[model samples]
Each structure stands twice: as C-alpha cells, then as structure tokens.
Target chain A: METKMVISNLLHRPTRTIISILAVAIEVGLVMLTVGMTTGMLSETARRVEGIGADIIVQPPGASFLMGFTPAPMPIKIGDLLEEKVEHVAHVLPVLILMNVGVGVNIVFGINREQFDAVTGGFVFHSGGWFTGPDDIIVDDLYAKAGHLKVGQKLTLFSHSFRITGIVEHGKGARLFIPLQTDEELNQTQDKASIFFVKCTDPGYTDDAISGIRQFLPTYPVRSMAEYTSLYSSNNLPALNTFIEALICIALTIGFLVIFLSMYTTITERTREIGILKSLGASKSYIMSLILREAATICVLGIAAGEVGTLGARRVLQSSFPTLAVRLTPHWMVYAAVLAMGGTVLGAVYPALRAASLDPVDALAYE
Target chain B: MEPIILTSDLKKIYRIGKVEVPALRGVDLVVPEGEFVAVAGPSGCGKSTLLHVLGGLTAPTSGKVLVDGNDFSAMNDADRTRFRRHKIGFVFQRFNLLPTLTARNNIAIAQHIQGNGFNPHRFQAIVEMLGIQGKLNHRPYALSGGEQQRVAIARAVICEPKILLADEPTGNLDSENSQIVLNMLRGLNRSFRQTILMITHNPDAAALADRVLRMRDGRMLLD
Candidate 1:
C-alpha cells in the first residue's frame, strides 16, 4: 500500500516526475558515456598494440608510455645493435611514430616492410598488399572504413600525398603505416626511430631479451608485451582521470539538485496529504520513508533509462565514427548507478525531514 | 460507562507575532464510552480547535486531556502521536483523502500506519457497510462528496480506534449526501457501539447525535 501510494503520488504529477527522471538520467548518462569513451579508446589502443606480436618494446629515455606522445629520438642503429648483441632476439623493427593533428588526432607509424613483417608475423591484408612506393601508405580496415577509403585512394599527410596500397585487418600498432625511409625523409630525421618492436625467437625468451636490452640501455623504457594492456588504465593518465572525476562531480551535482528541488516541491504540494498521514498516526520515520522511497524509485528508473540511453549513444557514435570505440562495461555502470543513488537520496533527506516535521493541524488547515 | 474522553479547563493560545489569540479557553468536557456526541458552534467558535486538541493534533496551552485512559497533556509529542495511532481516529470536513490513492488504498494506509497490516474481513465489512465496496478502486476525484466522506470514515475506523473525532464530516456534502453520511455515522454508532464525537453547525446533523453540546466564544455553553 505504501509503495502504491508513493507511485501514485509520482504519477499524479506526470510532468514533474518525467522532468526529474530525465534530469537524473542525463546525469548518469553523462558520467557513463564520458568514462566509457576515454577508457574504451585506451583499452582498444592497448589491445591493438599488443596484437603487434612483439615480445618487448624499447623506447628512448624519458619517453612516454603512450607511443603517439614519444618522439623519434633514438638512433635506428639500436634495432641492429639489439639483434646482433641480445641473445634470443629473433627480429628488431625500429619504428617512427608521427602524431597527426590534421582532420583528427591520429598516430602514423613508419616501418621497413621486411623488418615489420618479420617482427609482427606479417599483416593480414584485407585488400591490396604492402607499400609499392615511398609515397604509398597502408591503412588498417577501421581507418579505411572511417575515411571511406579504398585501395589506390590518395591520402594526404604531413603536407605530402601518399597512395593507399592496402587495407589491412585492424589490431596492429597503428592505423596508418608509411615506409620508414619516406617518414624519416619527410621529418628530416634520418636514422632516428621513436621505438623498437623486439620479437623473441621463443615466447619464453621475452624476459631474457628484455634483460639483455636493459643491460645496454639501462635508462630507456623497456616493457614486456604481456603487461601492455594493464598500462592503459586511468591511473596511468592522471589528467584524464581528473577530467573524469570533475565530470562525475558535475553529474552528482545535477542529480542532487534535481532530486532536492523535486522532493521539496512534492512535499509542499502534498502538505495536506502529509498531514492526513500524520493524523492517522504515521510516525516521523514513516513519512520520511515515503519521501525517500519515492526518490529512490525515481533514481532506479533513471539509472535504467541512462543505461539504455548510453547504449544507444554508443551505437550512434560507433556507426558515425567507426574508429571511435565506446566500451560500456558493467563495472562503470554499477559505479555510476551507486553514485547517482547516493546523491539523489542525500538530496531528498532535507525535504523528507521537513515533511515529517509538519504539524498535522496546520497542514490539514492548509489550503 | 466511564468517560472515554475527559478534559478539564483545557486552553489553547495561538501566538502570531506577539499577539496571543485564544482558540480554546478553559473549556471542560466529557463523553462516555460508545456515546455519539455532537459539538455545535458557528465558525471560529473553537469547535475544530477542541476537536484538534482532543485528537492530539495539537497540544493544549494548559489543562488535562485524558482519552482512553491516556493523559494526552502529560505525554510528549512522540508519545502523543503513538497514542493517537492506537487510540484516536480523525475525519476532516474536507474529506481529506490522499488524492493520488484509490479509495481502498486510502483506507488501507490507516491500517498500515497502525502497523497491523490489512485485514480483508474487516476491510470488506467496513466498505460494504459504508456502501463504498464498488467504489474502492476509484481515486478521490472520481468519488462523490458523500462517497469520499464515507471512505474517510472507513479509514478512521479501519484500525478500530477507541474514539473517532470528526470535524464537520458532512459539511461539504449536499442535503441528500449529508443525510446518507449522517445515517452511516448513526449506523456505525449503533451497530459497533463506536464512540464518536462530531463538530458541526448543522442543526439536523447535530440532531442525529445522542447528545448535543454547544460552544460560543471558545467556551462550552450549558444545554
């Protein structure tokens, strides 16, 4: 009966109820979508990097873990030195990475075809083949689909035109790949490489190879491929995590204020009804429960709506931008739901107490 | 029968920004168990004020109010509320049913508040006696004034309270509905021997009570 009363009260004011619900939904959706987008991009990039089949990665001293942010400061001879000196090193591919800010943010990799093929077990080409000329490039399927590009299509990068020679399967190191000599020539950085992808003769020799590389270049960043995905967490990027925290605070504020105003207005509107309840021997706790239960019901409904809305938004985003990944994991959904529920319930406390404190006589006499 | 309600020199003063306005002025009253008593007075003559005091809806400024062997004046706010829930039931002139709930839920809410849950047999008997069994599912807006009042009465008695306090229960009804509601009150009094105290200005409504008490200028007048 109490549940029925609470539901009926909410239904009685349909417009207010819907507005309140949508406000909570927007808060939850904002938190879920923003967090999902950032984490999704990170994990997706990490997975692709891992898919390169490299046993280990060696970057210059002080180089960022993010491949796109690292500069090509290491000499290309480091790859030759590692292959010649490090035991169990099958192949070492020296790669240059360029951060292209044109059109959109993208990472372009420069690699020698033979060395890259040997290190990564070769690319699975969906169409066409490896680079035919210095001015030609190979794009992953996701990038090609996103750009609506086909084999033989011309792609301009770094103010230089390159023909697309192949559309390869995704889940490699980078979306766009160009010849190493061409990249070094365009950037005027001959013999400079950003990182080295080291392939071990046997999977068990990864630790031995990394130790061997670390012996010569002690200050450089040497990471095993097995731990690559774990490096892409929010904790690894404080700025992104802070940005997510700020958004969560904003979402909390939105939920709190909406619930507060909604419950306050409902209490005021139902002052007489509250009085009637009091007159019928309803305790203070009962009245509080009534108001709190109503708010909680709204939050639960809003959370469900937000989940559905976020999934729909994800679909729209992925379809419109194929390369963009939006990962809606159950963990973050539960987190957002708990935060929304806490904030909404806290918002309802004042109004519930005020309603419970109302004098039955005055409330009954209220017009 | 011993008096179920007893008040001695009861007084209530309302202070609006320093000016003290007296609503109930040292009024003494009594009604025995199972008696149907009517309190008659013109508007602002403290009829509703007396009912509110007796119902524990408001505390008195000074005096002793005893209902169902419980001292209302001595009890704290929470204790008074608990006593009211177990012993006192109230009906208002406006037919103060929750507009959002169906008539059946409105009545069941009282039982829920009483912490006894619902009793289908008692609920059925009460609704059938009030002729609101068919209208149970309808919200208050769909019910007639007389029907709404009937629902309110059923709600007040659903917990089988020791005393029923009504402040003009039939005030808003038409003559036909008023007669039906008054007859229902009479039937409740006779069939269940329920103790009822009603406040009204209607002479016909007062005439239906076993005894009528008049009030003027916040004081009970001698019959």
Candidate 2:
C-alpha cells in the first residue's frame, strides 16, 4: 500500500516527476561521460605507446611519462651510447616528440626511417611507402581517416606544410611522424632528442636493458615498456583526477538541489494529505518513510534512464569522433549510481523530516 | 458500563504570538462504552478542538484525558501517536482521502499504518457495509461526495479502533448523502457496538446520537 501510494503520488504530477528524473539523469550522464572519456583516452594513448615495441624508454631528467609534454632536451647521442655501451640492447631509436594542437591535441613523433623500422618491428603501411622527402609526413590510418587525408595530400603542422607520403596502421608511438633530421632542423634543436626508444635483443631482457640505461643516465627516467600502460592511469596525473572529482562534485550538487526542491514542493502540495495520514494514525517514521520512498523510486528510475542515456551518448560520441575513446567501465557505472543515490537521498532528508514533524491539527487545518 | 472516554476539567489553549486563546476551558465530559455521543455547537465553539484533543491530535493545556484507559495528557508525542494508531479512528468533514490513491488503497493504508497485515475478510465486510465495494477501484476524484465519505469511514474503521472520532463526517454532503452517511454510522454503532463520538452543528445529526452535549464559547453547556 505504501509503495502504491508513492507511485500514485509520482504519477499524479507527471511533469514534476519527469523533470526530476531528467535532472538526475543529466547528473549521472555527466559523471559517467566525463570520467569515461578521460580514462579511455589515457589507456588508448598508453596502448599506442606500448605498441611502439620499445623494450624500454629513456627520457630527459624531470621529464613526464607523457612523451608529448617532454621537451627535446636530451642529446641524440644517448641513443648511440645505449646501443654501443648497454648490454642486451639490440636497437635504439632517437625520437623527437612535439605536441600539436591544430584541429585537436595530438603528439607528432620524429623518427629516422631505418632506425625506427629496426626498433619498432616496422610500420604496416596501408598506402604509400615511407617519408619521400624531408617535408613528407607519415600518418596513421586513424588520423588519415579522421582528417579525410590521402597519400600526397599536404598537411600543415607547427605552421609548416608537409606532404603525406604514407598511411600506416594505427598503434605506433604517435599518429603523425616526420623525418628526424627535418624535425630537429625545424625546431632549431639539432642533435637533440626528446626520448630514446630501446629495443632489447630479447623480450625477457627488458629489465636488464632498463638497469643498463639507468647506470648510464642515472637521473633520466627509464621505464620498462611492460609497465608503461599502468603508468597512464588517472592517479599518475593528479590534475586529471582533480578535474574528474570536481566534475563529480558538480554532478552531485545538481542531483542534490533538484531532489531537494522537488521534494520540498511535493510536501507543500500534499500538506493536507499528510494531515490525512496523520489522522489515520500514521507515525512520524511512517510519514518520513513515505516521503523517502517516493524519492527513492524516482532516483531508481532516473538511474536506469541515466545508464541508457550514457550508453547512447557514448555511441554518439564515438561515432561522431572516431578517434575519441569513451570507456564505460562497470565499476565507474556502479560508482556513479551510488553517488547519485547518495546525493538524492541526502537531499530528501530535510523534507522528510519536515513532513514527519508536522502537527496533525495544523496540518489538517492547512488550507 | 464504565466510561470508555473520560475528561477531567479538560482545557486547551491556542497560543497565537503573545496572545493565549483558550479553545477548551476546563470542561469535564464522559461517555460510556458502545454509546453514540454527539457534541454540537456553532462554529469556533471548541467542538473540533475538543474532538482533536480527544483523538490525541493535540494535547490538553492543563487537564486529564483518559481514553480506553490510556492517559493522553501524560503521553509524549510518539506515545500519543502510537496510542492513536492502535485505539482511535477519525473521519473529517472534508472526506480527506488521498487524492492520488484509489479508494481501496486509502483504506488499506490505515491497516498498513496500524502495522498489521491486511485482513481481507475485515476489508470485505467494511467495504460491503459502507456500500463502497464497487467503488473501491476508483480514485477519490471519480467518486461522488457520498461515496468518498463512505470510503473515508471504511478507511477509519478498517483496523477496528476502540473509538471512532468523527468531526462533521457529512458536512460536505447533500441531504440525501448526509442521511446515508448518518444511517451508516448508526448501523455501525448498533451492529458492531462501535463507540462513536461525533461533532456537528446539525440538530438532525445530533438527534441520531444516543446523547447530545452542547457547547458555547469553549465551555460545555448542560446536556
């Protein structure tokens, strides 16, 4: 009977109920989508970096694990030193990475074709061969498809134009690649490399190569490729975690305020009905439970709607921006639902208490 | 029979800002078990206030009220509410059925609040007696004034409370509906020996009771 009353109350005012549900849905969607996009992009980028086939990476001291943020401060001779001096090092590639914010934020890697091919197994080119000229650029299939690019198309980066010489399969170090010498000259940092990619003679020799690199460049950041993906988590970026937390707080506030106002209005409108219940020998807890139950029902419905809405949003986002990855992990979905439920329940407590404490005589006399 | 309802110098004062307005002025009353008693007065003569006090809806200012051998004045808010849940039922003039619920649910809610599981037999008997069996599926808005009143009575008595406190149960009904509701109350009183205390200004309504008590200006007049 109590459940029936709650459902009837919600159905009695369709517009208010719908608006409340939408508010909660929006809150859940906001939290899920924002967190999903961040985690998805991080893992996607990490996977691509791992696909470069480097057994170990050596960056300049104080350099971030995100290669895009690292400057070309390390001398290019580090690659030759690791190759000649370090044991178990089969190949070493000196790469200069620059962050490009043209249509979107991306990293462009500069590589010597022969050394890059040796270190990274080799690029599986879908079309065109290798960089034909110093101004030629090799793009991955994803980047080419996103920009509607074909071989021989002219692309501009860092205010310099380059012809597309090849479209390779994705999952290399970066989406765009250029000649190492040209990148060094263009950036006016000749003989300097942002990082060194070391390929060990055997996959099991990764830890040995990392130790060898650490002996030579003790202050430099040498990370084994096996653990590279784990380093791309949100915990590695405090700023990103803070950003997600702030967004979640905003979503919680939205859910809280909407539920509060909705329940407050409902209590006011149903003052007489509350009195009627009291007259029928309802206890304070009974009245409180009724109000809270109504709010919970709305929240449960809103959560279901939000889950569906977020999935639809993910599909739309991925379709619109194929390069964009949105991962809706089961744990994050559960977390978001719990957060929304907690906020909405907290929002309803005040109104429920107010309803419960109402004087039966005054409530009955309330016009 | 010993008095099922008893009041000793019952007094209730309404505090409005700095002014203390007395609604019940030290009036003593008693009604024995299974009696149909009527409290009649003009508007604002403390009839509803007296009923509210008797029903444990409000506390008396400075007096003793014992209903069904429970001291209402001494009980705290929660205790009073519990006592009301187990021992008292109420019907108001407005036919205060929850607009959102069906007639059936409105009646069932009382049983739910009484903390007892539904008794289908009692429910059937109550609905049949009130002639609301066919109208149970309808919401309050779909029912006539008389039908809504009947539903309200069924909701009040579904738990078989020791006392039924009615405040102008037929005030919103026409003469035909009022007569029907009054006759139902009389039938309930005679058939089940239900103790009823009704408040009204209608002489005809008062005449249906076994005894009529009049009040003026918060003080009960001679019977």
Candidate 3:
C-alpha cells in the first residue's frame, strides 16, 4: 500500500518528479565523468611507462611521473654511473622529455636512437625509418594521421621546420621523438637529461636492479613497472586527489540540493494528504518510510539513467577525441551510485521528519 | 449497559499567542455500545471540537476521555495513534479521499494501515452495502459527490472499528446525495450494530441517528 501510494503520488506530480530525476541524473553523470577522467589519465600515463619496456624509471627528486618538463634535470653522467656501478643494469638510456608549449597535446622526448633501442626495443614503423639527421623527427602514426602529416613532410617544432622522417606504429609511448643532441642544444641543457630509463638484464631481476640502482641514486624516485599501475602510483601526480575530491564534493552538493528542495516542497504540498494518512492511523515511522521510499526510488532510477548516459557519452568522446577516455569501472560505478543515493536519502530526512511530526488535525484542516 | 464512550467534564481551550479561546467548556458525554448518536450545533458551538477530542485527534485542556474503558488522556501519542487505528474510524465532510488512488484502493489503504490485510468477504460486504462496488476502479475525481461519500463510509467501516466518527458527511452533497449517504449510514449502524458518533448542523441528518444532542456556546442545550 505504501509503495502504491508513493508511486501514485509521484505519477500525479509528473513535472516535479521528472525535474527531480533529471537533476539527480545530471549530478551523478558529473561525478562519473570527473572521476573517470582522473583515473583514465592515471591509467594512460602508467601504460605509456610500461610501453617503454623499461624495468624502472628514475626521476629527479620531487619530479612528477606525469610527462612534462622536470623541475630539475639529472646529469647525463647518471646513466654512465648506473651502467658502470649496477651489475643488473642491462642498458641505461638517458632521455629528456619536454612538454610542447605550442601544442599542449604532445610530449616531445629527446632520445639517442641507438641507446633508446638498446634500453627499450625499437618500434614498428608504419611508414618511414628512424631519424637520419638532427633535422629529422619521428612521430606516432595516429598523431601524424590526425595532423595529416606523412613521411618527408615538414613539421613545425619550436618554430623550426623538421622533416617527419619516421612514423611509429601508434604505441602508448610519447608521440614526439627527436635526436637527443638537437633537443639539448635547443633547450640549452646539453649535459642535462630529464631522467633515465633503466632496463634489467632479466625481467625477473627488476627488483634487484631497482635496489642496485637506488643504491647509486638514493635521492631520486625509482618506480618499478608493477607499482606504476597501482592506485598508489596516483600520488606521483601532485594535486590530482584534491582536484577529484573537489569535483566529487560539487556533485554531492548538486545532488543534495536538488533532492532536498524537491522533497521538501513535495511534503509541503502533501500536507493534507499526510494528515489524512495520519488520521487513517499511519504511524510516524510509516509516514517517514513512505517519503524515504519515494526518494530512494527516484534516486535509483536517476542513477541507472545517469550510468547509461555516461556510457553513451564515453563511447562518443573516445571515438571523436582519442586522447580523452571515460573509464567507468564497476568499482567507481558502485561508488557513484552509493554517493548519489546516499545524498538523496540524507536530503529526504528533514522532510520525512516534518511529515511524520505533522499534527493530524492541523494537517487535515490545512487548505 | 456499560458506556463504551465516556468523557468526564471535558473542557478544551485553544491558545493563540496571548488569547485563550474556549471551544469545549465542562461538557460531559457518554454513549453505550451499539448506539448511534448525533451531535448538532451551529458554527463555533464546539461540536467538531468534541468529536476531535473523542477521536483522540487532539488533547483536551482538562478532561478525562475514556473509550472502551481505556483512558485516552493517559496514552502517549504513539499509543493514541495505535488505539485510533484499532478502535475508531473517521469520515470527514470533504470525503478526504486520496485523489491519487482509485475508490477501492482508498478503502484498502485503511485496512492496510490497520495492520490487517484485506478480508475479501468484509471488503465485498462493505462495498456492496455502500453500493460502491461498481465504482471501485474509478479515481476519486471520477466518482460523484454521493458516490465519493459512500466510498468514504466504506473505508471507515472496512476495518470494523469499535466506533465510527462522521463529521458533516454530506456537507458537500445535494439533497438527493445527502439522503443517499444518510440512508447508507443508518443501514450500516442497524445491520452491524456499530457505535457511531456523528456531528452535523442538519436536523434531517440528525434524524437518522438513534439519539441527538444539540450544543450552543460549547455547552449542550436542553431538548
């Protein structure tokens, strides 16, 4: 009977019910999208590191794992020191990765082709071969395709035209690669490199290699491949948690306000109806449950709709913009559902209490 | 016969900020089991207030209301709500039917709240007696004023409460509808021996009851 009454009540006020549901759906969608983007960026970064085929990456102290200009570059001598001191070091490639300020989408890595290949095996080229001179560059196939560039085309980097000598087979590594000497000369850091990618003699000896490398460079951050994929690795991106936390707080506030206003007005409008129920001997708990059940039903429906909407948006976004991904893991979806539904339930509490505490005579007499 | 409904010197006062307005002043009343009693008064004569107090819908200023030998004043809000569900049913002038529900569901809700699932025989009997069997599926707006009142009566009696309270049951109906509703009330009282306390301004409505009490200035007037 209570369920039927709640359904009927909501049906009678179709406009209000629809508005409330849509409001909740939009808020839930926001949380999913925000959290999805955060986790997606983290996962994408981890995959790029794994694609390098290096057992460990050593960054300058306090340098972020995110691909960007390091706060301070480590000397090129670190690579020589690791190769000479660490017995487990199969190969060490000193590289400088800089964010392209002109086109924020690409992170340009300055690498020695021969040494990079020794540390991380060479890529499969879709078009041409590797850089033949200081004026030549290699790019990812997707980036080249997206930018309508082909081998032998003149590509602009730092206001200088360089020939696209090779197109790599669209791997997860940074899209832009240039000769290490050219980048060092251009960036005025000829003897300094951002970090070193260290390969282990054997895949199973990565742990031993990391400990051996750590002994040489005690101040640097050395992360193994397995640790890079874990959630704990997210700490390497400074302020990432704060940004996601702020977004979730905004989502919760929107959900709370929408449900609170909708349910509060509903209880007010149904004052006489509540009185009638009370007159019929409905207890306070009965009335409270009736209101809460109505709110929960609305929230669940809204969450399901929001989940579907997010998935549709994710597919469209991923196809249109390859760089952006919407990760809707089952764990995050459960969190989103719990958050949205729990906020709505909290919003309904005050109104339910008001409805429960109403005086039957006064309520019935309410015009 | 022992009185099933008893009130001793019932006095009720309403406080609005600083002013105290008396609605019932030292009025004593009693009705035995299986009795149909009507309370008649003009506006502001405390008939409705008396009904509200008897139904345990409101607390009295200084009074003792004993229904079925249980002191209503002694019971807390939760107990009173429970006691009302099992012991008293109410029929208002406006029908007070939930607009969202069909006529049948309005009655079913009463039984549901009373903690007793629908008894098909009792429900069918009430619907048949009230002549609302055909209109069960229609929402409140679809039913005529008289049919709505009949449904309200059916809902009140569906739980087979110890006492049924009806206040201006036909206030919104015409002469024909009012007569139909009055006839149904009398029939239910006679057939089931149900104790009924009704408040109205209509002498014709009062004539249907087994006894009539008139009130003026919150005090019962001598017949």
Residue-level lDDT tens digits of model 1 in A210-311? 899999899998989877567998899999999999999999999999999999999998899999999998989999999999999999999999989999
Candidate 1, residues B82-141, lDDT tens digits: the string is 988988888888999999999999999999999988899999999999999899999999
**Model 3: share of native contacts present?**
0.81
Give candidate 3 regions above 4 Å deviation. Answer: A102-105, A127-129, A132-135, A141-157, A162-167, A170-172, A228-232, A236-238
TM-score per model for chain B alone?
0.98, 0.99, 0.97
RMSD of 3: 2.2
Query: DockQ for each of the predicted structures, in order?
Result: 0.90, 0.90, 0.85
Q: After superposition, how far is residue B124 of candidate 1 from its true place, in Å?
A: 2.2
The 10-residue segment of model 2 chain A with minimum total lDDT is A64-73
* Stretches > 4 Å off in candidate 2: none
The Cα error of candidate 3 at residue A202, in Å, is 1.0
Clashing pairs in 3: none
Model 3: DockQ score:
0.85
TM-score, every prediction: 0.97, 0.98, 0.94
Write candidate 2's Cα lDDT for B102-149 as tens digits.
999989989999989899999999999999989988999999999999
Classified by CAPRI criteria, candidate 2 counts as high
Residue B148, candidate 2: Cα error in Å is: 0.2
State the displacement of the C-alpha of residue B59, model 1, in Å, after optimal TM-score superposition: 1.2
